[model samples]
Target: MAFDSSDLKPVGARPPLLDYLVSLWGARHFVIYDARVRLAVSQDHTVLGKVWLVLNPILFGFTFYLIFGLLLQTNRGIENFTGFIIIGFMMFFYTTRSFVAGARSIANGQNLIRGFSFPRAALPLAINVRQALSQLYVLAAMFALVLVVPPSERVGLHWLLVIPIFLLQTVFNWGLGMLFAPLVHKIPDVGNIMAVVTRLWMYSSGLFYEPSRFTDNATILALFHLNPLYQILQMTRGVMLYDTLPSMEQWSLLVVWAGGVWLLGLIAFWRNEESYANERR
Candidate 1:
């Protein structure tokens, strides 16, 4: 058997990166529709429907406050520990959810990838889209909680900065999904591994507690500063609580992480585009 043909293209061939980007742009409507459908399907079984979006996090915040604030007194040094806990958990979970969904995007959509000819990046992009949309409800709940709870942050120009912060985080999530998708596709069980890994990342990312607690140790403090998520969290707290912009240090780290990861992920995932078409279970 011999085969050498320049005229034949693989049936599932992915176009060049620029072509792929153009295809994704063309498929933007599909992405939006798919994301909305997924969110609807996710809530299909829940009796409370959209209410769960607001209720779930509210309950989680109350539980954390009971243990960390009321019992353990984790709020001792903080003025608005109530808002603190909510912001930390809510903000951090956005990225965590993005990671999990992105990791599973390829594996879960293997059927679509094999059966369809669209850009594979669409799947991961849709995951981030779904999350960002859902956050609309969650953030509303968070803001309401902030006002009713102690140490209220008045609404002003500073609060508006959260919009950009969220957009930046979404970019970061998009990159994360791009980075994790191919790896998860190569190892299906890597999805499960990432779950545990992100759990650890959650704790280490300064979502559960303030980083100031570690001021006594330079090493620990520096470690927190290095985490892009922690940087976002600290900046978010400052905005919502104090009406301030991110310090120059935080701004530098955020931009570098978001842009750098996005570029890297785009290239890395593009390299695997053709391979994705053949990845069927």
Candidate 2:
């Protein structure tokens, strides 16, 4: 009560964009280190444990292959159909889990938010890291599937592109987490709606059918390009399975989604930082 105004930390004071980013950069270790620890803790409860990371996507691909590739002959238009399905489904799952995690991050971390004084951004950062780390196993499994599956494709320099592709997706997911974390924190029901949104996203994202199938319909094709998840999955499949560079259009879309969403998310999330501390219910 005796302190001057300078000593009083304003409740809910948001840092400028540049300074907020600097703080996040400085806290990168906390994000990564804590993520690793939490990743382990997060996995301990499940019976199948981390095995599900690799198994789940592979199983999903099998279901898609059974219906689309084998029954409906959706793969008729595409070469290396096995490899294509594997890449599309597995990679799409990464972003799905990332968004789900990000959407739930803030509301789930209320205890920490109420108790700690550290960076609120770190929670979303950690969620992305955890998702990415879990994905490493799945990525490895996908490569193995590519090698063993039909229409065998050789691994080459382009295979190395998975690293950058994953990096872009990770950043994109982090941004999404930032954008939704605050909103969901404020409104608990948003989580239920996000579940439906994610399902529609997966179905429309061309996980099994090639986007080229829609080429006759210019409007539909154009809409597919607008979906960042679709673009990223297309880009990943092009490089890893097709052994060709992604079209400039796909690359540009991924870059824009990754950079634009992450920047917007950070700003939005930070703007509400003060409220997180006092949020109840």
Candidate 3:
């Protein structure tokens, strides 16, 4: 596992791993520049540019509203279906994009893989950072939308829970991305398969309907609570809708799951790091 100096094969003025890490840290400007350009390119070429950030979750919220709010009438007991859906969808999208987009990052960066010798992992990390920042735009729109359409209960101090929740979600996203990195790199079709899986995941995560609304059976309730996404969403709903903190059990589960997933993904991705630069799609 050691990078022996004698064993190294230099590429251009390629720095040592430690030096690369240090330089990468100092290259904050490069990271920011790359992030800004990618964000702009991804946004500008589209019809609405940055507004699409707002539009995506809004569109999803309205669609869920029609299905769960009206058709199924799943808004029972709890109030403010719109706020509920908005928070849930926006947060869930973070995980979904991480899963789908992160899955393809290596293959997508094929050119960089062939051309550059810096941390191959940075490419994926950069994508994750870019997407995370994009989520803030959606968060802002969520606040504005909720203000105009005011939820039944006031947004309380518990809304601040979003800070930690997002941090946990980001780590979880990184883990998911790393875990999938090699899979997509090898099979390619796994990326397409993940897209379908994530859609199914959204339906099951109570993005459209609250899991609690479905049933009271112990087995069914247990199943819903066990879903990590459900656990995270439950924590979010407790904060935003009820203005209450999650139970200690919920917080514990979030920490355990996020930590476990992240470690697993990091190890999985690192194991194959040496192959990434040479792999052909």
Q: Highest lDDT, which number?
A: 2
Given candidate 1, what's the lDDT at residue 90?
87
lDDT of 2 at 245: 92
Higher-scoring candidate on lDDT, 2 or 3: 2
Q: In angstroms, how far off is 191's CA in candidate 2?
A: 0.6
Worst 10 residues of 1 by lDDT: 207-216
**Residue-wise C-alpha lDDT for candidate 1, range 1-281, written one tens digit per residue:** 98879779876676788988999899999999999998888877888888987788788878887987899776777767888889988888889888889878888887898777788899999999999999889999888888777677688778887888888899999999999889888888888888788888877787767767746688888888888889888888889886777888787889899999888888888888878756446
lDDT of each residue in 135-247, candidate 3, tens digit only: 88987887677667765456667678878988888888878887899888988888778878988888888876766666778887787777788878878877877767889
lDDT of 3 at 176: 85
- Greater lDDT among 1 and 3 belongs to 1
For residue 235, what is the lDDT in candidate 2? Answer: 82
Which candidate leads the pack in TM-score? Answer: 1
Expressed as tens digits, the lDDT of each residue in 54-167 for candidate 2 is 888899889999999999888888888888889998999899898988878888988887776666898899889989999999999999989878777788988888898899
Clashes of each: 0, 0, 0
* Candidate 1 structure lDDT: 0.84
- Assess candidate 3 and give its TM-score to the true structure: 0.88
Off by over 4 Å in 1: 1-7, 279-281
lDDT of 3 at 103: 70
